[model samples]
Target: MMYIRTNQLLKAVILLLFAVFLFLLHETGEIARFINPQYVHLSQIASILFLFLFFIQVPRMFTNSEDDLCGCGLWGCSHGEEGRFAMKHVISYGLISLPLMIGFLFPFKDFGAAEALKRGVQYQVSQREARDEASLEKNVQELLEQSALVLHRDNFVSSLRALMAYPTRFVGKPILLEGFIIEDCQDEKVTVITRFLVTHCVADSHAAGFILEHEDSLGGREEQWLQVMGVLDVKQHGGVLLPVIRVIEWEEIEPPANPYVYP
Candidate 1:
């Protein structure tokens, strides 16, 4: 690839793309070693080389006269003497290329330190949340192992009451919840999301509810509720219980006339 003969136009394009790709990949953690700034010394040097090549091609590319182009692939196709060269093209090139050249020549260390700090803080918070959520899950597991009973109709009702009081706290719990299909499962299962309610409004609301894997699509029609009496296993992340239901049994029943939870 190094010896692959290429025109200046293609070379400039490839270099520009190289810079953009490097930046984007760095953002996504896809180019970790390259963006490390410490270990990626050779990569940084390669970037500088590409940038230099791109700039050296630019002023040549903007030149109207083929004579001004020392080489065959100096620039894109151009209009001859009949047209005057536009200042916009050259001015725009200067505006873009100057900062890039300067930044490459003198990269900021303080700015990098701040960026690293921000990323470190974000990572710490993420790890902390994961730990807390793990601890809570262990507690729930211990509770279940001892004599803690699975959720039933009465507890589900109580959970609902609790859900309404502290919507954020319990709304996302994996309660062994059973409700009538009331309506067709818009997406999956014979289950309607009895808990996917939003507080501010439906727009801001998330349909955060346990999915009851009822196979029959039309088994429970409107107004036909179901009996969901099982254990409500709580798997929390960032203090939010991700719904993971352990279904005991489900039976058909009449749906409550007023079904939507008033958030």
Candidate 2:
């Protein structure tokens, strides 16, 4: 019937549009804003696969009636829903298409300090084996030799992990690092320099960083990226000893191309 053919064509157009949407996200490299860098290759593969499926579905749009066989020319062909028009089906299709529409209309944003607050920041490190401790110390030493204990974006997660694990080992040692501001206390003199640590992807991202103690107020610095140079110091906070960064110098910096640090 003409009605069946029209519905089939509409479905095919929707499928084609969804495929194009995903393909564009991958092409623009904006997919990283939503997903982990490690899984970018998988997203790329999915985009290609979607486009391939769209091409296969294109033939259905021209057919005046359902084909007795699928694209593979085999028996037991299936055209999902087969011209059925029900509220449930319509709602389901709308839900499926909603994300595509939103992505097209809204600009992609990297997760920021507001998201970090909901997730909370973690800084404590647990005990490690003697051999592991030695290896970690050696690695830290190599980084320490690079003046002011500079931490690069590439190794930010691992280096911070090492520092957290062995706070005493790194105490009095100066460090240079970068992260966005996280409001932590009523007193505007102190704030947390926080990084989003993504173990697998953005879905699992968690805030990680050290408490920064500065004489200057942090009233207007919330969510702003800052490069901090300081010495690691142990301070008593809330009746517990915690590692704090005694900030010697800090400056506002532009956000990095890839804002999330992978563990």
Candidate 3:
């Protein structure tokens, strides 16, 4: 009679599931939504490791009492009984499977204004302390030399930081930006165009963006995606100097497939 070890079988199954889950995330391009693309190769290596471990575990499932003994052939070195269930093992396995369950069951959604508010939206680069002023000035000079200043996911965080650090230098420079709107409660005509900056993964993501000023009312546009072409300007809000965009032309747009910016 062939007896399968329940514990070994469970481990094999979990390992296989983990491998599949990681592969699926990469295959569907959903991994970009979670981690920086540069570290994707690391995750791929992890999936391969899980698969190798699963294969190694497969043979252990069919081991009998004689096979369970260590190479020293001592009975005391035997692995625990095959069919025995332990609460500790169950709890450990459950904890391991929790992230897998959440990843597979829930769909990935872009962080909205409500989520940004919870994280405390950063409207200007000055909101953060401990900046390298010299480096920031150098970056701002390089950006100013460019004929056009466009903000995309790749340069979103850096450009905003430099521009906000030296708002006067960037003033009157035509710029383009895209992000979701976060309405300001204190000002009716002002709205924040916000993006989530992810240094490593979604867990550490935080809000960073520019405050936009429009001549017309910006009500009822909260949390909506927009593309704005404007000139950079400064505004004093809540007793802090902030870099603001004076809108020249703007339009509503659909949210991007991958909305998070990786720094």
Candidate 4:
């Protein structure tokens, strides 16, 4: 009869499954939802490492009792006894397998208004002093030169920061932006156009948006995606000055495939 090490087999299977899960994430382009694209090459390297470990484990699964014995020559080998059931082993394996199960079972979901609310929407730009005043002035100058500003994922963070930092400079300038709508609890009449900014991963994502004001009622439109063309203005909120968008022409739009803005 051929003796097979069950624990070695389990380890090999798990390592291979992890590689497959990561590969699938990249294949389907869903990896962007989890981590920054700059780190994607590192993730690919990890998947390769797991695959290599899986191959190394294959030989151990068919090892005989003598092969399992260590050079220390103890009374009984501590290595090949993983077939025995133990609470600690079960818990360890279960914990290790939990992320794999989740990756395979659940569908990827983009961060939404509920998540933004929980994280607390950042209506104003950070008050940190600019490290490069010359560079900052140059970027702001380029934006000011534009007749109309259009916000896209690539330039969303920098452009929005410039506008928010100098709201007085951008007042009455035509701007086009797209994001999911979120209603403010304190003011039912006003709604926020929100986008999540991801630094490294979804865990570190933070909501950034502008308060929207319209002549027509904006209520009952919460969580819907919209393309808004409006004029930029400033408003006082919570005793702080923040940028506001006075809607001129707006239309309902489908949510973008890549929703998060990367900084």
Candidate 5:
């Protein structure tokens, strides 16, 4: 009886912890800090389910002593006379609760240029389909004809792709860009302007950016967000010729609300 009661208490606690985890994600509006913004509705649904389960477990703790809450005959409940909560059971639950405990202890952090460099930035963008190259080039030319080819959050990834795909077409064309600085090469004259390209979620996220070449060193600019108004210059870096920004005007800026750019 005592073992069953203890097991019920542990189960209730675990359910409540799960509920709180979901609640905090939504309450703090930090859900965007982890996953893509589009999937926030799914997180909302899961939080509701967890809260419902938590409430169900709360009443069960007082009404039933020997009843199995999980209802899985294979685990968590023992019906026999020798039934006892073993040390392994506690260890298993502890392991299950470890992630929740760690989340509470640490501040939520988003993956940035540091993680981008580790994954390696995509210097040259490629298209698998031939038609895409032509269409991308045409659209880029239209944009470049404007006063300045500005790259905004919605079309940032696509703009970079088009520019990288046809470097010569965009060479010397005035452009605008925003991203964090990442420097991996020995030379300090150039740095990568990187953004997290998240396809589905942060786990599948990777960094994408182009090289920025300037006469002055980008010292003390590491991991800082900046907006660059420049013209593309085809330059050689790491034996590959890619578009490098010849910066005309630049200034530091705050990181955007949604750091990850989606496809």
Candidate 6:
């Protein structure tokens, strides 16, 4: 009888955690954009509910004298037969939940959410267009100026795909990118990391690629925007050559209005 009740209590806690996780994920961007000012009241109400359950469950768990809190069937809960409460469960739950809570905070805002990835590229294209407005006035000047026409969004995506699909060393090809200083590890070199953005949302972003030869500016503050001019170059690391956009000349720039790029 003690074991069955404890099992039910544990199931309730798990279900609560799962529901909260789903609720927050679904709310993603709108989590901050609360439409109702009274939502703060809603949050407080939810907090009260959690605290009420916690207060009850914790004491109950502490007082439990079950012979099988974990279970005793195919999944034997008999790891401990003692009537005394075990903090092992508490510690285990905390360790497990902490990371999952952190998971709720990803793909990280460093790169604007995945939507930003598409927008940043478009924004860049737009800025390029704005900067070139005067060239359209000059017929001969237009011929000399190689504007990065939106050839196609897919065309730009293909270049990114090439880098992703071919992670090996590459020789320099014409490349243009803008980002801020992550930290320059460059010595006689100018090693720096420009973000290769892949994001699902602003919360959970991943970064890729580095210009080691350009480590000269690697130690700059995190997330400083830079416009890099380079060619594709391949470097061998850990027995594999990975392609990198080799730096030619890099200049600092103001960050775009929308600052993330997604794959």
Off by over 4 Å in 2: 1-4, 65-84, 126-138, 144-146, 185-190, 238-240
- If both were scored by TM-score, which would come out higher, candidate 4 or candidate 5? 4
Please give, for residues 1-263, the per-residue lDDT of candidate 3 as tens digits: 45566777788899999999999999999999989888899999999999999988877666445445232121122256444577888899999999888888987787888888788777666534326777777788889899889999878878988877777787788999999988656543457888998878888999888888888855578899999999888888777777888998999999999999987
* Cα error, candidate 2, residue 247 (Å): 1.2
Those runs of model 5 whose alpha carbons end farther than 4 Å from true positions after fitting are 1-4, 63-83, 126-142, 186-189
Ranking by lDDT: 4, 3, 5, 2, 6, 1
Off by over 4 Å in 3: 65-78, 126-130, 184-190
lDDT of each: 0.41, 0.73, 0.81, 0.83, 0.75, 0.46
Candidate 2, residue 231: the lDDT equals 91
Best by TM-score: 4
| lDDT tens per residue, model 1, 1-263 | 11212234444665686676555445554433223333345665666676777787764444444454442334443334213435764575556566556545663321121222222211011343345555445544443353433344334333333332233443234344444333322332233334322233223322223434433343434334566644444444334444434455666765443232323
User: What value does the lDDT take at residue 178 in candidate 3?
Assistant: 95
For the record, the alpha-carbon RMSD of candidate 3 to the native fold, in angstroms, is: 3.3
TM-score of 1: 0.26
lDDT of 6 at 171: 50
Candidate 1 yields a Cα-based lDDT of: 0.41
Indicate which candidate wins on lDDT: 4
Please rank every candidate by TM-score, starting with the best. Answer: 4, 3, 2, 5, 6, 1
- TM-score quality measure for candidate 2: 0.82
Per-residue lDDT for 75-143 in model 4, tens only?
A: 223463555757877798899999999889988788998998888888766656255556567778999
lDDT of 5 by residue, 162-219 (tens): 7777777777788888999988653434587888888777888888887887777665
Output the TM-score of candidate 3: 0.88
Can you give the TM-score per candidate against the true fold?
Answer: 0.26, 0.82, 0.88, 0.91, 0.82, 0.40
Question: Across residues 23-57, which tens digit of lDDT does each residue of candidate 2 receive?
Answer: 88778877766676788788778777777776776
RMSD of each: 18.9, 4.0, 3.3, 3.0, 3.9, 13.0
